[model samples]
Every structure is written in C-alpha cells, then in structure tokens.
Target: MKSSTAQYVMGIDFGSTTSKTVILDRAGNMVASAIAHKGSVSNDGAMVSMAEALQQAGITEADIARAVSTGYGRRMLDIADKSYTEITCHARGAVHLVPDARLVIDIGGQDSKVIAVDANGLVSQFAMNDRCAAGTGKFLEALARAVQVPLEEMGPMAMTAVEHLSISNMCATFAETEVVALLAEGKRKHDVLGAVHAAIASRTLGLIARVGKREPVVMTGGVAKNVAAVHHLEQVLGMKLRIPPDPQIAGALGAALFALDEITSPDHADEEDRVDTEMAAARCGTPTCTAKKPLPANVHPLHGPALH
Candidate 1:
C-alpha cells in the first residue's frame, strides 16, 4: 500500500549577504523558494522570517516535516531541525543537481570554497579562503565600480577585452590602486576589467589546486555566472568549469535536497546515506515528490552530524 505520509521539507541558507529558503517535496523537487535581500536575520527574528518565507511558498508552519539550516548564520536558527556547514550543504547540493560533478567551487559574496567529491557524491576533501574578500563576489562588485560600470554589466563587458592587462595585487586595497593606475594609463575599460577578473580567477584557481584538480569542475555561488570571471578561470586552469543555471541558488537547492533525503530514509541518518540516496534517485531518473506532513510546534530542531 502507498504510504499516506506527506513529506515536505524546508532548507534555509542564511548567507552573510542574503537569506534564501527552499521548499521541496519528498521527491527532491523544488516547490517554492523565497530570497530575502538583507543579511542573515538576528537570532530572535530567524523563525519569524523563516515562517514568512515558507508562507511565500504556500507552505504552512505545520507542513515542514524537517528543516535544515545552513550558511554563516546557521547556528542562530534555533528552530531548525538540524544545522549543517555550508561546505557540506554545497557539496550535497551540487551533486544533487549534477551527479557527475566531481569538483565544486562555490564563490559566495564574502567567501570561496573548493570541494572535491568522489563518484558517490561524498565530499573527499575541501579548502576555503573565507578570510578575504579578494576572491569573492565582493571583489567583482568593487572592480565593477572601479571601472564605472553597473555590476550586472561587468561580466559581458569584461568578455570584450581583446588584450589581457595584468593586476599586480590580490589584496582588495592594493587591487583598487592597481585599477586606478590602469585607468590613468589610458588602458581600455574592458582590458582593466578583464585584468581584474584574471586576478580573482588566479586566486580561486590556487584554492582549487589546494583541493587537487578534478573534473568536471562545477562552479557554484553568485560569481560563477560572471562570463569574464568564468572565462578567465577556464584559461588559468586550462580546464572547463561547469556553471549551473542560477548558481546563487545551489546552496539552498542542496539544503532542500538534503531535507528530502532525510524524510525518505528515517533510519539511515548518516550523511553518506543521504548523499547515496540523492545520487541513486538522480541516476534512476525518478521523479521527486512534494508530499509532506505538517511539523509539530514542539518538535525539537534536527541536529547535523557530529563534527569530527
């Protein structure tokens, strides 16, 4: 007999710059997701904001059977059924979206991470450079301003550079100085922008190398969509990087997929089992379902795997 249990899960990525919530059915299909523009909500406000996001997705507070929170402010989400590091969530999310992804480079607004995944979608090792803004979305935003172009136009404009100018510094302050000098030199705006992209790509490639090069390299996070950055990265690495549709949503998507896996397999709560199930479903071409039961108000938040 078909089980009547409805299985709706909620995944919230409370990033440093923005917060996003995704609702998925038991089958791991995205039902509804909402993105909030501001930074992570304060501890007292997380539940309220999360509830509002759920409502936006037509999810009642009672409908979410499991809630997994990730990102910089994940620990502040006291109401979550569990909380996970952004690295694990991103790796699982990337593998869920692209099963063949062996490497994941997630460059978020303030941090960048490179994760190596085995054939089973398990994260083998990873490295991150979160202490600096030089290799992240903020770096690109600052460069766009230095070039007097809107941020959205930076990517396509960067691709137009016929000559590759060199940026001497990786530090944001020093790089800004370099950009000013390039501008004074009467270099083409596109060339300067290309130089900036090249600088960030070089630093990111260094991080990827630390994790060991592997293919197919899947680039996630907001900066992955920047054509110039992507192009420069490919050139520097001498390998093609795969950028998925809506790269900014990868973490949230991964969290949602993790939620689905938890609901489907109650007994096997290990991270490896969850990854295996997601990979299996993706490989078998099974349709992800959206059925879920309402969560009880008093139920305790889910806890992630114990840190080693």
Candidate 2:
C-alpha cells in the first residue's frame, strides 16, 4: 500500500467473438486500449490484444502492476491478477462511460444483455439471452450475408431504407432465411436491412421488459456501432441512448478499473503475500488466489461493480 498510485494496471476481456484489452494508470485514466475481433479465442489472441494496447500506451508488461480478466473466456489468461463476470465488468464500464446511465443494453457477438444500474451507478438487476444467438451481433452478420452485403456496410445501408420490411422471424437461422426470401421477392436491400434492425430492436425490448427500464439508457458492445440499431432501439424504447465513443471496449475498461482498485488498495501488499503463500503451501502448481476470489458476502453476487 505504500504508494502504488503511479502503477499501471491492465484489463483483458477475452470475449466469444473478440478480445479487448485496456490499460490504465491508478488514477483510472485510460492509458491505452485495443479491440481485436477474432472469433477463435486463445491465450495468444489475448496476449496479442494486450501487447497492442501496451504498444499504443508506449508501455510494456513490466509496467503493469496488476491485471484483471473478464468476459466469456476470462479464465484463459493465466497472467490476470483477477477475473470478474462480464455482468459486473460491463456495468462498471458502462457507468464509467456514462455516469448517469441507469440501464445498459449490450449486444455482444453471441448474446445480448440488459443491465439495470441504480442511482449509485452500480448494477441492480440484470438479464441476458445466452442460449440463443438471436438479437445479437452474429445474427446481424448472418442477415448481412444473406442480403449479400458486407457486415460493416449493413448499418449505413439500413439508414437509406425508405420503407420497412417486417421480418417474420427473430430466430437467427430463420431470420437469415427471411432475409434471403425478402431479396428473392424483389425487396430493396436497404429496406431489408432496416427491417433487420427493427427486428433486433423489438427483441431487445423483450429483454428490457424483464429487467425493467430506467431513464438515460446507454448501450455498449460492438452492436452499438450500428446507427440503425441505436436509432431503431431508441424508436422502440422511446428514449435517446447514450453510446460511448468506444462502446466495444467498455468491458475491458471496467476490468482495467478493477485492476486499479486492486493494485492500490490498503491491503494490497498483504493480499499479494497471502496469495503467494497460498500457492506455495498448497503446491498445487497454480496461482491459488489470483483471479479466483468471489465477491464478498456483503455484496450482491451478480451486481457488484467494485467502483473506486
């Protein structure tokens, strides 16, 4: 605890569809961050993303005093000092990006989540759709392919849509078929794209219903880059959304923030020694306490964000 204030910390979010890394100084300012959309995840991919982030920050691994990992493949990073759920990390990152944010909607590659953050800028209730790929980024990618449009071009194409084509299904596979059918029926590509956005927005509304709504909603994940998704979701929810400039890296940012908290805590030195001792004594050939501690009993298991 003797002035770890100048230390730099790292956060690695090894998600299902992408790997993102963020570095921050103890003051919680982002030093550098990088997101790599690599569908197949490995330690090497995480390392590459972290290396890129370090390169951007003009720093190296030696500079990072602590690190945390989050997202679907969080445990793959053996170097992480800690690991937290994406629910907690996403909430932390969203609140950091938009402090007034009450509801956070994240449409990640394989799933979508709706998180409710309370007045204190911490998570309250949360809901997610992990079983199905519908209403997620992958769903959009499938539809884009069906329409013969590059995935990156679909959003802008949707913007030019003058008419909406109601898609019959929200299921990802069925929706792809619908997109193809719409095209065969001589429908406009832009209009089909617009309908896809609305279909996703409508499905997101169902998630929002379960979590309930709060004003000043913000969105994160790669899907936030889609103007039509944001626009259609806003139209459906009737509230303007707050989107961070780097929405996709919010989870990594939150993990970096957690690292900052961990490295500078009053018990930092003691905890470090405790973890080392636990590993040595057990001789399990593992970092016994690193990234393995559960949330304290006083905090809600699913909603705690560990803010500074």
Candidate 3:
C-alpha cells in the first residue's frame, strides 16, 4: 500500500443535513476540508452536491487520486472510487482522531450511532439508532424553536440552568409540546433547556449502554459540539466523554483514509485503467452506466447510505 504521505485522496460525507469534503495526503494529514449546508442526498442528489463541495475546497476532479464516499448518500455517488457504510467510516474516523478510543458516539442530524473500536483502530462492534430522531440534530432544532432560541445557542443556554426541569416526552413533537407547556407554567428558559438536554442525554446513554460503556468514550458528529449535551451525557454515563476538535468532520476524514488505501492498493492501477476506459467511453457519447439514485425522503434504511 502506498503511504498516505505520497498521495492525495479525497473523502466526501453526504450527511442528512449537510455535506462535507476533505482532502488528505498519504499520511492522513488533512490538506483541506469544507462543510456545506444541504439536505441529505436521500432527499436530494448527494453525488452532485458532493461534487460542489469538493469544488468549493478547490479540489479538482483530477486532483483526487481515489475517492471514498460515506453517509446517507454514499451509494448514490456513482463517481466515488469506493463506498463505505457510515458506521464503518465513523469508527475509522473516530479511532484515527482518538487512537485510544474504545467507544464512539456520533449524533448526526437524523440518527445516532455507537461504535466500539479495538487497539488497531478497527471496529469491533457497533449499534445505531436510525429509526428514531429523538436525540438527533432535528430534535435539538425543534427544541430550540420551541424555546425561541437559535439552534446554535442551545448548548450555552442549557449550561445556564439553575434547576433541572423534567421532560416526560421522548418523541420530538411531544417534547416540543412539553417545552411549550413548561414555558406556559413560567419555567425558566435555562431550566427548560437543561431538561431538554437531559432528555437527549438519557436517550443517547441508553444506546451507549447497549454497547457497554468503555473508557475514553469519544463523541463525534454535530451534536458533540453541544457542551451541555456532552456534560449531561458524561453525568449519565459516569464517564468523561472526549470530543474531537472537529467532530463533524470525522466521517470525511475516515473517507480520506479509505481513499489513500484504494490508491496504494496493488489492484488500484488496474482499477484506474478500467475507470479511465469507462470515462472515455462516456465522453465519447456511449450510454454510460448510472450510479444509484438517492433514497426517497420517507425511506429510513437501517444502515447508512452507500459511498459514491
């Protein structure tokens, strides 16, 4: 395999509410990465959107020796050199960020995942909660709206609570209703926010407990940025959770690592030749094979989407 030090690889993560692209050298050192706000490829064309992200990062198509796509739209990216599940990519990315991480908890826009990793930065076992949106970004967004606060301010607002209010509802709609009721009762904003954080933390902890708590629980995904949620999760799990400096970009980083592997693999040369032939044929006006389309909006597949 070629060392990441000698080649450039590109990774794209087509997330549910945003897309990110990362460029890295053979050593897995990131050159540049960019995140763009967009709907999941499941509801939009993920591959086309990913291409735009790469362009924004100034990474031309030819600059990417190998590309790996992950997230909900992975399978829909026909241009990806390879595709991987979000769980695998998240595990790989988390392990790379925190080499000693035994457990990984990633809370994205639409779902959450828990992963266990071994000493070699490989996934051991994993669990996902995609069927519900209770502890996801969407849940937080709804809560923020109910509280008349910006989504970005939820974490700080949660930290200001002098008392922890009770949130009895786990459903997003019901939870929003609960917030409104609390406000009507004259509950302080901070206390209500704290309760919301606790609710999400409790739900997330339930998922983590299923995989068995381990030391150095690394939190990734967009939700990790929420300090209040992180604090609540730590209290619930009774273990300190480590958040990477750039948690949201972990999946894209892992994709870049996979790209490095594909470029350096012994079979890559032949694969490139085949890909070139295919591209040439397509350019010559031959009917080219199309990549898979994004999943429908209502479809909630258990596994993450394919890589392009």
Candidate 4:
C-alpha cells in the first residue's frame, strides 16, 4: 500500500445523528478519529468531524491519498471517492478491531444490526432493524424523557432497579406512552429505565437470531458505551461482549480501510462496482425513510472530550 506516493487515507461515516471521521497512515495504522453530533445527516457535522480528524492527525486534506464514506449520508459527501453501506463497513471495521469476532452487534443512534462475519473479515450474513426506532438509541432517548431523567444518567439509574417493569413492546412513540403509564402507576424511575434497557436487549437478540448467533461477539456503536444496555445484553445472551475503546468509529475505521484498499488492492475497481450496486439496493428510495429523525433535546451521542 505504501508503494503509492500517498501518505494517508481518510474515511467518513455520515450517520443520521452523528458524523465520524478516521484517518490512517500509509502503514494502515489509524492516526486519528473524531466524532461530532450535529443534527440528522447534517453536512456541517461531517465537515466538523473531518476537520477535527485532520487536525488531530496533523495532516492537511491535501495529504490524504483517498477517501471513502459510509452511513446514511454516504452519498452526500462530494469528497468521498467511494461509498459503502453500514453493513459492509461495520462488519469490516468490527473484524479489524476484534479479529476473532464471529458475530457483531451494532446498535447505533437510529438502527440496530447484527452481522455474521467469517474468519477473513468477510460478511457472511447480516440483519438490520431500519424500519423504526424500536431498538435504537433514539428509543432510549424517548424513554428517558418520559421517565424525566437525563439521557446520560438512564444507564446508571437502570442498574439500580430493584423490580422488573415492562414497557410497551411497540414502536418508540408507543413505548414512550407506556413509560408514562408505568410512572403514573407509581413505578420507580430506576425500574422503568431498567425495563427500557431490557427491551432494547430483547429487540437486539431478535436481530442476532436472524443472523445466527456466534461466539466472540463484538458490540460497537454509541450504545456499547451504555453500561445498563451492555449488562442486560450480556445477561440475555449468556455471554460477555467485546467493546473497542472507541466503539463509535468502527464504521468510519472500516471506511478508512476500504480507502486504503483502493490504493493498495489490484481489483479495487471491480469491488467498487459491486458495492455500488449493493448500496443502491439497500436504499429505501424515499427521502423521509432516509432522513434523520429529530433527536431528543439536550442529547449528545458523544460524551466528554473528543478522542484524538
């Protein structure tokens, strides 16, 4: 890959609620990564993340040899040389982070997906819940509001539950109503939050079943940082999960790897053609279907200082 004169490559994930960027050196090592929360599929968010990543890597945009993009707004980035679906990028990125991972469970802001990967980091099968926000971060955000708790505090409060409570097993909108009803019944906020997290675990398990469960499962995306969600998932799966230090950037990292491949791999053109067709088929062909839904007020997917 270093045979090319290019010194670095870049990958951007234009997610609905957040944008992520990753920069890699010629040696295929990640040099910098950044995440920005700016409304749904906002171009400003993408630019912010890319600028932060480049600044952290101490490189100019001119220094990057190639760039690839993935996620909801993948095609919206004019700077991207190529684009891939989240399924492909997430599978590739997860395997790169956890080489022994045979299963990947990615619960992002808008969707939840389970991918079955082979030893070579190739996706064997995958399943996603994109129809609604039933098992996603947005769902938790809605429940948090209904329970009158901060989004960031829901996880810890849920861990303190002493009773098992149940929320409506419907869409996020309906679930919020159920949460309100539970609170009206004098249920503790902690127990109600517990039910909310457990519900996500149950929905995620259904996705896992579709792709067939495998060992050494890896969890990625914003939800992996949620302690209660992870705990509930582990209890339900009867196994522990491997979480990367920075789980949100897995898709962007995968995009960076593909950018590297574009410079290094001999059959890159043919691979690009194949992925283009797949991306088209995966699209819902409707603006509203792909548009970013409004996130809860005062909610930010990223926590603390940006990772360099």
Best by TM-score: 4
Q: What is the C-alpha lDDT of each candidate?
A: 0.77, 0.83, 0.78, 0.86
Candidate 3, residue 214: lDDT: 84
On the 0 to 100 scale, the lDDT of residue 293 in model 4 is 38
RMSD per prediction, one decimal?
9.2, 6.9, 8.1, 9.3
* lDDT tens readout by residue for model 2, 112-225: 999999999888999999577889988998887788899889999899999868985459998888888888999999999999999999999999999998888989999999
**Per-prediction TM-score to the true structure, in the order listed:** 0.82, 0.85, 0.81, 0.86
lDDT of 4 by residue, 170-216 (tens): 58998888888888999899999999999999989989999898989
Name model 3 segments beyond 4 Å from true: 1-6, 42-58, 267-308
Count clashing residue pairs in model 3: 10
* Superior candidate under TM-score, 1 versus 2: 2
Q: Is candidate 1 or candidate 4 better by lDDT?
A: 4
Candidate 3 — what's its lDDT?
0.78
* lDDT accuracy of residue 18 in candidate 4: 95
Quote model 2's TM-score.
Answer: 0.85
Q: Model 1, which residues run further than 4 Å from truth?
A: 1-6, 39-56, 270-308
